[model samples]
Target: MSNRMRIGALLGASMAFAFSMAAHAAAPAGGLGATHYNLSSLKSDGHYDRFIVTWRPGSAERANPSLMRQSMGAALSRAGLVRATLSAQGMMQAPVQASYGRRLAIGADVLRTSRKLDRNEAAALMAQIASDPAVLHVAPDVLRHAVRDIAAPASLRPSAFKPSDTEFRQYQWDLKAPSGRATAFGDRNYGGAHVNAAWDLADGKGIVIAVLDTGITTHVDVNTKLAGAGYDFITDAFLSGRKNDGRIPGGWDPGDWTTGRPWQSMCTDEFNPPQPSSWHGTHVASTVGAERTNNGIGLAGIAYRARVLPIRVLGHCGGYDSDISDAIIWAAGGHVDGVPDNTHPAQVINLSLGGYGQCTADDPMGQAIALANKRGAVVVVAAGNDNDNAKYFSPASCPGTVTVAATGITSRRAYYSNYGRTVDLAAPGGGIYAGDRSSGEQVSDGFVWQAINSGATKPVADDSNYAGYAGTSQATPHVSGTVALMQAARLARGLKPLTPAAVLDILQRTAATPKVAPDHRIGAGILDAYAAVNMAINSGGTTSQATLLGNGVALSDLSGAKGSRTVYRIDVPEGAGKLSLRTSGGSGDVTLYVNRGTPATAEDYHCRSAHAGTSESVVLDHPAAGSWFVTVVGRTGYRGVSLVGKYLASR
Candidate 1:
């Protein structure tokens, strides 16, 4: 039979059920009478049904191993038999209609049945089979299925922040301007200044960050920088090949026209089919790694050196978990049997999309993310746009993921942005621009620069080439770009492959701390590309050194003690080799302890000499994966003695 017909028949047979009330019937007279059991009760009660039967070994002639196997096979082929397996002396068989409460057996001189069973049906089934004359023993079959429940978060707010004309022009200029060349204009356009500085270092060669959202229309800015293109997930086909008459790519490509409309209602809209919404993904992609001042046609991205890998995941209300999970895994260089491999594997996965819901570290989506991390992909998530604090959202709440919140130009929390301790850091998400020093009507002070999704036929908004959008969505790419920048910096320095932890450390440690207190909403602080890249280059260590000093010696004890000191030493054999340290508080008064070819010191001696504060640890070089010993000795007995440390080694 054909595959489809075979599947249909299987489904039909599996669903068919017949109930009848019949008294126990006598077993058929034969060499060994066999009885069947029903296991429906076991299934409903979350149990397994099993049966066991034992048969005596007979003489060689009577045993006839081949004959016994033939008999078992024949019984298994019977109409109701579901499965059968042979053991040493007998065989066990299960029937499709077997119930947990019944048991039967067939043996040489015995035909027995157990009282209606209870609890473990699998155990009861085995017991019944054991009492049979022709059978050895029966047991429940092992089965497994992939089961997971993912809590989807609430929807993100629609992009509401728009840049002013002057601000827009400033950003455009920054994109076109060269690095280190001061513009005749003052720092009034510092936003563009930051982008230019980042691009100067990026040199535009890195991983392709995939933006899985709406379909991106072919605009000058986007087309000029296009590395390659693929289908928007909604279409289930390539967006570039839709309506082409074999010459020009053409078709009914639905863009982001349904932005303000409800997803459900848009189902019936002629222009908005169940296909990729245009602008959302495009805009997000542009913000992440748009092409910089090459031909100077559009805005610049934080990682001007990086490329984009647009993988549309959102359409209609929102994409499904299964699809998003697939996109995430695929984007991170994972292999999915049927789908084409993501040609350009993304080192940084930017999720500008999120929803409301509690997601634990163990959820399937979280598991998939963990898998991505194992493969060296850094995931950046938006801390939802709900403007709430207490609740956590999916993909963001996923463990080991970098969740970002939104901040305005003044370094204040954006009113529409979400907040919580879960937020790792914040970035310029735009603010309510109070129109020109006069009318205070709230307008959007564009803080985000990205590509706009124009419909395939025309630009959706007047400023289709480029526009400013503000949200935690926009903020997310800032962090993603920083991650890319750090990676590129590490590459340029010839450092080891950047791990997720190292990336997070660089971003958090060098981030620009806001000027205000209780800055909980904005997270660690605003993103600082210069500081982060500097950290990567400086932290890439090529030398190895160990020093021994008494307690209360600062890292200045090792160096001259003038500049910022980043060094660390450890005593655990596992933490020896190369070390880096960073000190806060006093003007560099930390000390290092090495065994120096002597026998190991006592734990208390090491702890006491180390000042034993919680912040101190001994880091090691990369290939120095094994254990090593060194100690961190604090300089002062004063109460607040804390220091941070790390190390890098040759792999």
Candidate 2:
């Protein structure tokens, strides 16, 4: 999932993220006009032969349709381009009138030439309209593929039981690592995300996670109902790869296979190579809400019983930013023309896939994310497997997303996982690469193992059992699934649905601090599924205190004035292994101090305030075994900061 597949494919010259996960299977890097796309070569079989023209806002042409049509006619006549008005579907968006249809952006009209114009001629026509002084921009309405490369069957460990959970759980190291029965790898690894402890508190109930990917593929690991009423948003006839079908109402994966020659060179470079169907959407869907503890199926998901809503956006090659943007809006129950209303809106949306480039509040993707947030949806995105700073990728870098990075069995960053401030948390993305495959070490128990079928590859149940794939693509669901657990736990406690910021606050506040020394690269820390759900199920609208000795626990949402202070007491055993304290959430100068004295008059035995803005940590390297007070002093006003403390005792 790493190596050179980084930055899969760039969408022509447009700033788009259409790259794949395995090998690079996106539009070639740059130059769509020459090397990327040749209009004359298009088969027009599934490709549409029209262009969309959008006018700038406040343009008189939009309000006066007749004048706009006359101006367009004059431009077409001068350019000698015979054309008709039709949607990409060969029908008028609105017969005999300039209409308001947001299939494209608002105030955009589809222009069909008398005869099909190759992409080059389309570009020429766009240029002609641009000279009219009223046109905003013109585009070919290109097809997009989902962000998944070809599939090479995941390195699943050979297990003994029937292809059910009874056998699969033994290899699902992501949940019960070294504690469960030994894996085929023979190493009792103890580096999973530690989700079972949380599940005991509350298995996800009645939560909906919207998975926007290739769509769901049939598999026994998950309930078919898990695929919930989904819709395919791939509107481009050429990219749908379904002959001449338009957008449909079912969210299903239809093999996304691309050879070195992409879409007849619609967007290909010498660097792009051949890839098989990734079965990506299915892998992601099962990860978020797959059934567990029933019918003897595969491994359990982070959020069991959480309904899955599959919204198919990527197909043949990859999907467009426009399509994904619309999916976000529609998933949150926002309306999209020609597409029916979503009967069941999702509370949380997971995007295991990503494209090239970053998104800002003003960009199309950023705006869509903002809209989703307004509708009370939590958007979790992968921090791309590029190994670069995450701020350079779309959605991952976009605001409001709980950006996730990949971690290995050792709870360290995956070699290829992107990092930096954009990352919000880390999860098991599996990094067995530590072992030399040339040696006897099978990469078992290293990759995120789940149920994914490669029907586009071979015949039979060839690649469908249980498999593993590594990358932030695998880590994202861990966070998304855990989110479902938190939401369920919150509602069960009779609390209102959490806002996006509050959810992020809880996640970071309850996260397991990094095993290594503190660092800003992987965001707050590794996701502690047990910690998050435990707090959710217990954190009511009250300030409750508890007795925890030699146990790592979090005190969520503590806030007050600069002169105010909140104190927590901890009892360290004589031989406690370690002791630590940390603060997170809002932007405020907070100092964490530890002292074995009175709560109000305690002396500082340890103090930490590395960098401001909520996250503060203090460690007492081998402290005195006695009663101690953990105090948070607000150097500035505290607006909902969370404090966590841990005391590990060596048995």
Candidate 3:
């Protein structure tokens, strides 16, 4: 069975935690203005209650509107109910006094109050309502309470660094060295120039990336590096607080490891041994920000300077929507009650875990992600480990999120990675031959790296160390790290901080287009850390103009289908600036649009003509520093539009 179906079967019948009566017991002295109940038992507790009464479907008791109105009014008056209103679905939500025990039966259903019913009582009431012939499913009219968590000051590190011998081997010398140029190197050859370029900028400083997976262990790399103790939404304990040494705020707990065992559902025949510990979160963490050059160690991270804020949301049978939602909100820097404040909110959230499901705009998880973006956090999610495009998984499919697909070392999409238009970019997530795995592939060829839980004792195989595995999970961090590099470069240049949109722009614009034919699998192209950083640094804060044709033109001369449209290039300098188009001579309406590529769509930059007169101009503002194409088109059915474009200087 699918994970969702399994989880639904297991938890669908389970009740959400009840509010502590000691905490929420006190009703205002004046009483709750009007108590809404889904049950009939609560009416006797001196609290006014209201229940929904629906009409039976296809029940013909004479189709008289007057009769229906009179019947409802009589029932309300007899039940001592007040404020009765007819609903669009022919249902009524009326406030009735508890003393009136008269239960008026409509067809086979009765309307009553349930103010005395608690959480359990309400559930039973719903069950009863479901059984009623006149009712479909009765929803609790209880006041929906918002669960709040504490908010901390912004002092938490947004990124983290990994430490190990393998990492040291990867960064021992200048990453640019060609093969024999370096001495302390492993046979596993890799070009370091790109890695170094990435490190110089992002190292994840200032950007908050939340790891929504298994809780991180007290591994050496994590503890010494960017160890920002995150919350454990599952156990309701601060992970750092569980630390035995007390040096780190949260301590380690074995129960935190919730992988393996039968599915969370109660299926008796579905027995399967626990999968071996992957230490998935730790490995993912190292890739993004493993510490660099820490003497002798394991593989190096993509962004050595970045920090990590571990937010553990997945555990036993994956995680629940409620918990994941809370984690997303808190990780994005929103307040949650009970949990300590997230002092350092994440600027980027990395979600490597996803079940099989297609993406929808209205999905609850999608809504939560939208909230995260609104709070200024860029969410990056794996496309999925399954190699399919028809199914786009959650969190990744959510709007405003940067969905990442996986590419192999050769710049080809990985065989196991999902792909589609929803995918924003591709990154090098190591494949089979890239590292060592249990598949018996040669040491030099199989996936090999600093494996987490490599030396564990408890589960015996759960030790934290390095090992190489291949999946889109590994590829996501590469992009996350690049984003950090872009952000860091922007910060160094004294440029204003980037919004999520700006970051997306930089990533897409600077990406290296695939040398092979472009495919839907690889969106823009492979991630180019060096190019991205260069763009951010060299992008000056002004606008410059480009000439498409020689600086002379006549309206009638451009009349034919062969009439050439000049390609004016406008360069936006560093910082924010505006670009405008104007012409010395033109007849009909003129329109101007800006695009990054040929055949720009509505997503590109555009502005209407200022007027029909000569020297008329239209301006586009806040253009980022980059190469853009401005096209002038005749709008008034006129043969041609003549124009001169210039970059308006910014103050």
Candidate 4:
């Protein structure tokens, strides 16, 4: 794909703030911008009772959208879309009906079924809709919900521990996880990213990190980190419970609670019980920037000095990917008509929520991510708490994102933290447990701590707040906060802003793998924020280094998926006879090669260390006179490797 053309196809230049405003066209209504999908779907909590059908381009609907929706309903009636859908789904005996709505921005119309049909039946109807030559695309109005509260308990237990005055710090057990050991609070010690030390160097002064979840509450812990009134991307007034209020500009949480009565089915979900608004965004924002040591306030944040951009994508019931994608682009300083220019464009964005689906090239989430990356925003995503392969989740699976997994106090991958090749790194996702009285008080801490609102049923910000939550949702902010710290350090050092790719590279290269046992599923390894920031600040962004070699000196640098040659200059004495070079000590396979004279390019190499496996060796039968250059290359995936050189005297 021509990345240039795809990037140029930015919705920022053409989409309105929301679909209703599509007619006021400085841009198309800010529906799913540029995030076109041949067939995009969602995971609804209620049921799959609605399907959206778009009239194909060149169809009569192209000329008269109003009459077209009307005629299609008549045509589908004659064609019997409901019966066809039922029969095709082998639900011929099932009660199914259809009602059509007006034209949608995707050039489609909504077709709500009588009752919630099974997911298979909805897919079946969508298949039938696609076959109509007058249709461009068809997909379920898939339900999308908050990634948190997969299961929120009726009541939460606030820990009894209190911190000192210099630090009102709650037990941030995620900071250090000692392998195979347990903390005093009965939480396991495992692979933590070492965040405490990282905070000493940088506090994310000017960077803005956007949190796209329920929305932030007025919790004192993070009150000062607000990055203006971030937009509420929830376009549906009904879902937002505020009639006539569409995509307003504000970052406050209104609450997302539901009561399950058929007459008022807004809170009813076939799979889950009634739940509170979660205040998920507030909790996550605190992890990234709650003022620590604030005259004995609550607790400290990863980047207390950094500000947060609050964008609400999830509300009552759940949310749609269409709205979520729009918020992503807008947060990265991209344009969305009707939404004012973001004064605080975020350098980093944290998505602690995701829906169940792969982020393919045609997916809107992927497109949004691409736009964010193009605009210099590093997107960090949670790998999900499903304990399944992270590759199946949206933005997490999307390329150009830093996908993170969860590790507990014991420094091991959390039991519920999803794993796979797609995950980039792991951080402290709490595994705090309660002691089993029957089991002689075996301690287990099931969550991580941060400040939250006082109300359990609704979000009511209270100063006296501190609570714990678990999930990769918690792990993600850890990575995002450190990224802010890294960026802050970079700025302080007068270095150029780090691109998304550069940020990922430095974090991965500096990560420390556990000595206990290596788990490939956790990406490079557990995060070491201190080590990462150190590298980002002191390394000066050099991919390779210049070096002077001794007779037997060795040089090395960590190479990534893309092979960057680590070059070294060697001086040979007049009496030097033969030269030998090789590579060893690396997690990934690599090769070493040498050139006789000062060749301007890597292609001019005269001999190579082509021996196989990770280590390669080659010897020159005779010696050359001038300065010699030797290089090590990552033959495969990225890894840290060593290149050794030896000059043998005449034998």
TM per model?
Answer: 0.56, 0.67, 0.56, 0.71
Clashes of each: 69, 12, 67, 27
lDDT of 1 by residue, 328-393 (tens): 787788865345666677888887775433444333355567778888888988775555551334
Candidate 2 or 3, higher lDDT? Answer: 2
The best candidate by TM-score is 4
lDDT tens readout by residue for model 3, 462-572? 233444545566667767767767667777667755667656655655555443443446555566677666665544333334455322232333331211233466555
lDDT of 2 at 100: 22
**TM-score of structure candidate 1:** 0.56
State the lDDT at 93 in candidate 4. 47
TM-score pick, better of 2 and 4:
4
Instruction: Report lDDT per candidate.
Output: 0.45, 0.63, 0.47, 0.63
Residues 210-259 of candidate 4 have per-residue lDDT tens digits of 88887877755466346346988887676676776568878777776664
The local lDDT score (0 to 100) that residue 4 gets in candidate 2 is: 12
| Per-prediction CA RMSD (Å) | 17.7, 13.1, 16.7, 12.0
Candidate 3 whole-model C-alpha lDDT, 0 to 1: 0.47
Off by over 4 Å in 4: 1-46, 49-121, 124-141, 149-170, 176-188, 224-228, 260-271, 291-294, 434-446, 515-520, 539-565, 568-651
Quality of model 1 by C-alpha lDDT? 0.45
Q: How would the candidate models be sorted by TM-score, starting from the highest? A: 4, 2, 1, 3
Q: Is candidate 1 or 2 superior in lDDT?
A: 2
